[model samples]
Target: MKSDVIADWAARPGRHIVNLSGGKDSTALAIFLHDKIPQIEYVFCDTHKELPETYDYLDRLEAFLQRPIIRLNAQRGFDHWLNMYGGMLPSAQVRWCTRKLKIEPFEAFVGDDTVWSYIGIRADEGRSGYISTKPNVHPVYPFKELGMTIADIERILETSGLGLPAYYSWRQRSGCFFCFFQRTGEWVGLKEHHPDLFEEAKKYETERGGEHFYWRQRESLAELEQPERIAQIKREHALRLEQERKKRPNRPLIELLGAVLDAEDDERGCDICHL
Candidate 1:
């Protein structure tokens, strides 16, 4: 079925696209197919709420690819969507943010055309791409089909001169700075690196006359930003990193950090947002 889908898409004269997430995997996939698929359209569904590093990484990737990456954006943006949703912040269980900010714009871009969506999910990952369910949109996993792993992705980025986004040094995944999927350590990283954004995220959390909303399910950002809480999170993250390093002494720092973060929060984030 995979081979048939690949062949069918190759034979069709429809849209060929790769959605970038400003993360390593998607950037590597874009670089991997830069020469192989000249007609491939690279796109980023800009939430307009992503970290500055994410935008910088996307800019670098565009230069490396020597092509424009179309930025798909929601007509109203996050603030508008939040209002429409009754100021209820999106959570893992109620991920209306992904649907409004990412998927809707992507689907609108593809319209009714038969699109072959190239995904960057690696063979080592046990998750599938989150793409449009529309019958016209066909999802394809190039990295998985090609048997590429995390190491292969790193090699691709390195060879292409587009290494991982700077955020990887601290946070493992990529999405909005205030993404609810962020672990406690990542939230601390945000507070330390981008305090202004952290403040903005905190502003989002409010009682609003008896309705309590928080980015994290258990605690509010205000509470998480406390000095003692930040220190505790850092200590826990350090312990995890130490344990992971002891387990895999030869692993790359980036891989080790990712493993630690995954161990911290096993939930695989929104595939479209974090790929």
Candidate 2:
């Protein structure tokens, strides 16, 4: 049944939408599908707490696709929802952020309409894509079905002149700057690359009910931002990257960065936001 998606995608009775996360796989999927699915609508479920690089990458992708990438968001931003949760910063164990900032708004956008959600999960990925609870919204994995791998994704992006997001240089996942899923190295990268955003993330780390809520477990942004801490993280990251590079001498720098970051901690990030 899954094998038939590509053949009848156009004839399917639903609105087709490719959800972009401003990441390589999703962007490449959009590039691959734009000409094939003319009426396909591209969308980004903006948490509004994302990096500036993410928005810029989306603009470039929009131009390449020559289609408007619909920007969807919750009625209120992250701050509003954070307050609603009583200062409990969303962690892996309790991620209220994904539902409030992403999925809910996406569901609202479609509003009971039959929709085909295009996901970019590739052949190499074993993880599932965003399978909506809404019966009307169906997921179609073109990359997986087509046996497209990371190499294919990178090729597509490179060919389109819309390479990976600028954040890719340091961060693998593209979500909130203060995403609890981020590794210590990524936090270091955030501080070095986008210090203001790093500071903004720090503000969320607060003491509520005598317990300090931190994005990273056992560590606060304030602690992570210290000069010695930053240097330590950088040194550790460099060492890890060197080991990974030695393992795959021919791999691209971006891929190496991903490997090194994942080596630090591979939580797979927020499934919905990483899409």
Candidate 3:
């Protein structure tokens, strides 16, 4: 649907909301739908542990939107949840983080209002993100209905003067600084780009009892930081990129990025946080 058409939907009396995840797709969607949905409420479920780049991107988006993107949080934040979980750290198998940090806050924001949530799942993507089961919160997919693909999303962000998230240079999705869904190479990038955040992530893995947990099941940040391991991960990533280029020479760099991440680790990222 065109912007004018969607504008009509936003012009209605009921609450219209868009959740920004600080990721490329969601950011693009916010930019694309901003002028069209003049009254639409924009929100971000802040985990309070996101990368600095994420916060920066949100600020840029907020300026572009010309309004506050409401920040939601559980009464306490990530540290509170981590302490409650005995500092084990959240993984795909037990994603208490998403439920507490993202979903609950979003639900609380909507409250009893009948909200129309606009999601940014592209037409090319096969999987669905978080769609609230709340009877009052209706989810709508403008990208899907309009058949907008990855190329279209890039165009939207490019034209709107809000390129891509800074993290896109290494990481694909946006979430917490130490999201378990990150690839090994991206983890390396994290260390190189933001060593302090990397160290903070490492600190979360160790506890008072001397017990240690890791974001990746097979590796720890200390081990991953080894020069040899970092070199190996870089080599593997380079080889994978070369192989991907051979397989799909005509695809854009974005598509190649998705493929590379899938090849390294296919864990589906947090929908509520990454959109």
Q: Give me the displacement of residue 143 in model 1, in angstroms.
A: 0.7
lDDT of 1 by residue, 105-210 (tens): 8899899998989999999998898867899998888888878898899889888887778998889889999999997778888888999999999999988777
lDDT per residue for candidate 2 within 84-138, as digits (tens), equals: 9977889898989988888888899999999999999999988887799999999
Instruction: Write candidate 3's Cα lDDT for 92-164 as tens digits.
Output: 9999999988888889889989898988999998868788989998888889878999889989888878898
Give me the overall lDDT of model 3: 0.86
Query: RMSD in angstroms, all models?
Result: 2.3, 2.0, 1.9
Our model 2 lands, by Cα RMSD against the true structure, at: 2.0
User: lDDT for every model?
Assistant: 0.87, 0.86, 0.86
lDDT at 176, model 3: 92
Top TM-score prediction, candidate number: 2
* Backbone clash count, each prediction separately: 0, 0, 0
> Model 1: runs farther than 4 Å from truth?
1-11
Best by lDDT: 1
Clash list (residue pairs), candidate 3: none
Which is the better candidate, 2 or 3, if ranked by TM-score?
2
